[model samples]
Target: MYQLAPNIELLFTEAGDYHDRVRAAAAAGFSSVEMWGPTGVDAPSTPKDLPALKAALEETGTTLEAQLAEPRTQFMIPPWDHSEFFRKLDEGVEIARELGTPRIVVGSGTGFGGWKRQVQLDKLIEIYQKAIAQIDGSGVTLVLEPVNVRVDHPGSLLDRTSEAVYVARGVDSPSFGVLYDIYHSAVEGEDMRAELAGAGDLIRYVQLADAPGRGEPGAGSIDWVERLGWLRASGYDGPIGLEYYPTIESAASVRHIVEVAARA
Candidate 1:
């Protein structure tokens, strides 16, 4: 069975703070959870009490599947300066170490206006290669995410799974790979099987939500069984983060996917 790590930022909100959400998710019988940023540098994701969050994880025996890299890297603009992103990476990795998180989700922010798409993609290769070198042997893998331009993230540079796969290939490091978000892919209308086949082993992490609405699995048109089957066929044996807004209570929101994923 595939392990499902609910996004504490969106799920279990009734439990109070971030640390309390961890305990709440564990109480709901989830063994793992995922979250947004650690230091709250990114908006919509408040700063977390790292020590308290770590204690809660330990107390519940829950694994932190992943966390977002701070200061979202928007590389394509004219005055492109990535100093802060590089500087804070060590801090992000340290927080990950404290929480025992193995993967950090990185993104290619809004498109660099006036730059050719191919050139922008190549630039990502250079950036991540340096990042991998910096974080080498840290035991923290950086998973590049391609957000959809259609619904959630407009004008984002990396929106296609194939492009993310290309960047991963260019980086060519064991420490870097792709994070295939099912909701984003579905929103972009990519063929699930074809994309997964193209991605192959480079897909180091996965996340899901119903497309058209970005709600819990059952709230959209995606065929959970078929999608999960394609994921299984692609040989991805990793945790699938429940990164969606809950339309109902937290526990009730997960029931559909839990039942469907059990057999998947």
Candidate 2:
């Protein structure tokens, strides 16, 4: 059976506060939750109460599956100084350690206008190589996520699963891998089954929202049952994060997909 982790940042909004959302998720029968960043001070900041968030997790026995290393600056693109990026990463690592979160998500910022794609890819590998060094022995894994450009992220540097896999292979560290967001992949018209097959163990994490609408599973065009079943059959036994907007009540919205995932 697959483990379900609700993205507290999006789901459980009825609870109002981030900490309360953790309790809400736990009450609704979810054992784990994920979030964007700790401080919530990133672009389009969510500024959470870290103390309360931590207490909620401890009290509810809810595990923090992962969190995004926020403010996705131009770290992966050209003129790649990555100085501030590393500093933020250090802070994020400290927070992750405090929260007992084992994984942190990262993004490939927009591509440089003047640089070739190959050069950008090389720079990403170099940057992540340094990133791995920075977080070495932190016991936290870094998951590189690829966002879709066709709709959501217009100028994102990395939009393909193949490219993410390539970069992860280049990094070649046990502590670094890819986060395959099914919603983004489907939005970009990717062949999900083939990509998952190709990703294998390099896929360190997975997030899902329905395609076309970025809503709950039944709200979009993709086949949740078939696709989720494929993920299970492919041996990806990691936590499957629910990262979507609810068309109805959060708890009610997730019931079917949770059942589908359970069967998968």
Candidate 3:
């Protein structure tokens, strides 16, 4: 069975604060969870009480599979000042260490308008290479997520999994890899098996919501059985993050995926 980690930012909100959500997830029988931004620099995600969050995770014996890097970087924009991103990365690493989180999810913000697509992608490699160096030996794996531009993240630079793989290959660090988000891939209309085959082991992390509405697994048209089978066949044995919005109650929302994943 594939281990599943519901996104705390979207799941278990009924339980109260971020730390309380962690406790709620554990009460609902989840031993793992993921979240966006530690300091709440990004919108839609609020600042977290790191110490309390750490305490809750320890109390629940829950593993924080991943958390997003703060102030999501925008490399393509002109006069590109990435100093803030680099500066906060150290802080992010320290927070991850305290929380016992394993991976930090990164993304390619909206593309630079004037540059060639190849140039922009190569730029990403250069940036992440420097990022990996900045936090060298921090025991943190940085996973680059390729978001879909179709329905969500319309101007995102890294929309294709293949392009992300290319960037990862260029970065060439064991600590650097890709976050193959199933919802984004499906929304972009890429062949899952082929992309997974191409990505191989560079897929350091995974997240999913359903396309059409970015809802829970069974809330959309995806064939969870076939998709999960392809994911299994791809040899990625990582925890899948349920980054979906629940149309139903949070506890009830996960039942479909929990059942499907057990058989997958």
Candidate 4:
């Protein structure tokens, strides 16, 4: 959470491959950059095969901020598949260990068909609680983000920071918490400043993108400075993950993001 070492995935336009985009981020003066989970490894980021990737990170001075993770396929359409669920969780933990990444995101996926609503919710909560324990003290936190169900992530379990906050409270462990994404809040018609101000404690990481286009902060209607000012004011001394797809070059938007959010 140290000022969100920038993630290069956002800058990936239709222009080039992910590797080239990462190189571009390094050239643009970022000391540390974030790469996607499975994409971090050259071909496959297995335990035995990650040394080369480590070399690459050492070479570029880029660190893995957090991974989007392998998705919730097992939980997505569950006949309540605990077997597949725990298996992927184990794999994800191994992958995180290999990458030296401190964070991995886990999603509480949609209905497993024919299950009652409360049943699904309880199941999800139970699974996440166990998952939290599985990754305990691994130097990694399984960050659960709240998305905008109205548009992008329909049927998403963790759709509000409040909900995420609740889950974090239930799990009640340092290994589990919420990764607050600002763009989703804006789209959901939340007062960005107020939300963070109220629940900053439960949040472990914070990301930004402006609504309407999920682009850079200043590019959209979000008052980047004012909102970020609140974070600093509220004692959020963590990385503010820049998970935006700028309508321009990736590095081109960094300075603007920093400057604008600096209240400059």
lDDT tens per residue, model 2, 1-264: 778899988899999899999999999999999998778767554888899989999999999999888656566345556688899999999999989899999878885667899888877888889999999999999999999999889989999999999999999999999999999999999998899889989999999999788999988888889998888877898998999988899999998899898889
In model 4, what lDDT does residue 67 have?
69
Model 1: colliding residue pairs = 76-112
Q: Summarize candidate 4's per-residue lDDT along 229-259 as a digit string, tens digits.
A: 7677777777667787777766666777766
Tell me how far the alpha carbon of residue 177 in candidate 2 is from the true structure, in angstroms, after superposition. 0.5
Candidate 4: list runs displaced more than 4 Å.
Answer: 12-20, 39-52, 73-76, 111-120, 262-264
Span of 10 residues, lowest total lDDT, candidate 4: 40-49
TM-score of each: 0.98, 0.96, 0.98, 0.84
Model 1 lDDT, full chain set: 0.93
**What TM-score would you give candidate 1 relative to the actual structure?**
0.98
Candidate 2 vs candidate 4, TM-score winner: 2
Which structure among the candidates has the greatest lDDT? 1
Candidate 2 has a TM-score of 0.96
Candidate 1 lDDT by residue in tens digits, 1-264: 999999999999999999999999999889999999998888999999999999999999999999999887777655788888898998999999989999999999985678799998888899999999999999999999999999899989899999999999999999999999999999999998999999889999999999879999989899999999999989998999999999999999999999988998
Top-down lDDT ranking: 1, 3, 2, 4
Q: Candidate 4: give its CA RMSD in angstroms.
A: 3.8
Ten-residue stretch with the least lDDT total in model 2: 71-80
Cα lDDT, model 4, residue 106: 66
Q: After superposition, how far is residue 82 of candidate 2 from its true place, in Å?
A: 1.6
